[model samples]
Target: MTLRLAFMGTPDFAARSLAEIAAAGHEVVHVFTQPPRRRGRGQSEQKTPVHQLAEVLGIPVSTPASFRDPDVIAHFASLDLDLAAVVAYGQILPQAALYAPRMGCLNLHASLLPRWRGAAPIQRAIMAGDTMTGVQLQQMEAGLDTGPILLSETVRIKDSDTAASLHDRLMEAGALMWPRALAALERGSLEAVSQSSDGVTYARKISSDEARIDWSRSAEELSNHVRGLSPFPGAWFEMPGEKRPVRVKVLLAEPVSGEAAAGPGTVIEGLTVACGEGALRLVRLQREGKGAMDAATFLNGNSLPAGTVLD
Candidate 1:
């Protein structure tokens, strides 16, 4: 069945799904993404991943700031889309835009419905020590992610999984889920199941302030925090020096059995630090303005000696 589809998304995850959907032979007539924003070290304006991919695929693209304006809503309506698939589009669609398609909008959310249903689901789930997370395809509504689920598949959160790793796995899972969903839709057998209100939680956006490592927490907790923020806006701590404090990002850490009697944040031996409870051994870390390195290599070049306190 050749159905005219509109894709609304931004970011690499969404772009991956877009590629798979097109490859599956769906007619993605229009691609809507967020406006180009300045990014990177030079702060040059950059198009979103989805926008760039749409151009390569020769799909018409829209970057409207909002859809509440009647003209924007009318423009969307004129497309006469059979369905709209949205994944991390980063904008709240108005009721008019929600109803623009014949079958309404279906969203590819990173986490299972009713849990981690917001901007930073992937990061939040890891930080919360959740053992499992999944991708969900749901019918989008005016309410925030409070929609009926059409399809879902759970993925285990490995003990060694970081935010970057989990995100890649979920992206691949979501890419595969789209074709299965489309097949069901084509067969007219896809059912929308109302999401359970139980275990409802929101995964708020990760903030830089929150990325500062708090040594007062337990080692296990601190390890989870480090893993959750890995590879982006990394969890960090400051080490005292003769002249000034140097900020270092902790990319990977693990809780060790040994206990330290010293105060929290006290450096023990070989990248191990005392916390409020237990001890965490930093495995991989990065200095400000430097690339990441293993603990042994980082220690050989850096000057974090025993008894030094971290902030």
Candidate 2:
């Protein structure tokens, strides 16, 4: 029997799951996404990735400011959905909406349960230097990602993995796992385990304030920060000259053993800087408003002479 599903999501990550669900032969009754918001240089209202995809698939889309409206509730109830699959929906589901689905609501979260339980899990996991992170399908229970887990798959965090790269991998893995989970649901054989109180951590949203690179920290710490924030709101540092700091976004970096007595933020070599304990070689970087370039390109255009101080 084709499960009647109400798909709810807003971002690229969520769109992948919705595509997978449709390809799996489920009947998606409707899609609920956040309203279009102004974006880009023109500041024009733009639909989210999920919204675009829903339209392409000819599925009805709903963008409500809030779920408290009786009219919205009535419309949602009218769908008569069997289940709702939510991925990065960016809104709180009320109790009435939760119960509207016969099988309840299932969310595709980006991190392992009982750890990194809130927004920005991918960035948080890399920033904390965690060894492992994964995706979980959990039964929503009003609380913030505290629900029981329906299915999960673990992925190892590589030493050089960045948030963007890890996010792509997890999205693919989540799509692969969703079908099996849904099959179990259909067979009435799915099991959910309550999350443990231990290892609980909230992945607060990334802030621009935290993007500034503090060279005072150890090499390992700075390297983690760089990789964690890589590719978005990138970790940056101030360079000498120019009234404002020269924002350099680190795209790639690796820890290296060095005994430079230079202070933190001091440029010891062409592409290496001394940290609190060790040194790191900047592999790839980008100047503000410029495309990412190799170390040699960055040096040729904006050389950091030896002994130049950075922050």
Candidate 3:
């Protein structure tokens, strides 16, 4: 039986789940997305990934700023949805909207619930050097990610995984899991379990201030920092330039042992910088006004000789 579904989400990660849920033969009657915002170099207004897909699927879409509006809540209730699935929707649903659907709301969160309960879970996990993380489908409630679990799938955090890579992995997991859970819901066999209270930790948002790389840290820590923030709000250090200091983002890096002979932040070898305890070699870097490049290509264009210090 095709359940009357409504999907709420913003990012492409959510977009994939919405696609799969629809493909599973659910009647995705409507979609709720955040409004289009200016993005990219041109700053052109762009619709959210979910909204774009909903349009492609010929489903009606709504971009409500908030559910505080009584009309917004009533409009959702009018849909008479069997269930509403949320994935990185970026906004918290109030109780009025939470129970608007006949079966209430379900969320696919990136991290294991109660562990990384707040925003930026994927980034925080990598930055904290966590070895495992996964997608959790939970019952939506008034509190933050405090919901009970309906289903979950775990994946190992690889040494080379960045937030971008982990995000894609979790999205795929959600795409598969959402349909499975929906199938169970269709049969009334799905069960909800309370999340364990022992390991609660919040994954706060990544700040712009946290982007600057600190060379005084150990190479291993610096490596995690780099990978954690890679591809967005990247971990950066300032390079000495002829005119002034230049900011460069380290998109990929690995810790190397006993390599640097200089003080922390000093270049001891080609793209290898000294840290407090070890050395980190820059793998991929991006300079302002230029595209991302390998350490070799970046070195070929500019010079960072031995004994030069980066801040």
lDDT tens readout by residue for model 1, 94-121: 9889988999999999999799988999
**Reference-based lDDT, each prediction:** 0.93, 0.90, 0.92
Instruction: Kindly list the per-residue Cα lDDT of model 2 for residues 46-134, writing each as its tens digit.
Output: 99999999999999999999988989989999898999999999988898988899999999999998899888899899989999999
Per-candidate clashes come to: 0, 0, 0
Please give the ranking of all candidate structures by TM-score, highest first, separated by commas: 3, 1, 2
TM-scores for every predicted model: 0.97, 0.96, 0.97
- Compute the lDDT for candidate 3: 0.92
lDDT comparison, 1 vs 2, better candidate: 1
- RMSD to native, candidate 3: 1.2
Residue 176 CA displacement from its true place in model 1, Å? 0.8
Model 3: ten consecutive residues of lowest lDDT: 253-262
| Order by lDDT, highest first | 1, 3, 2
Cα deviation of 305 in candidate 2 (Å)? Answer: 1.2
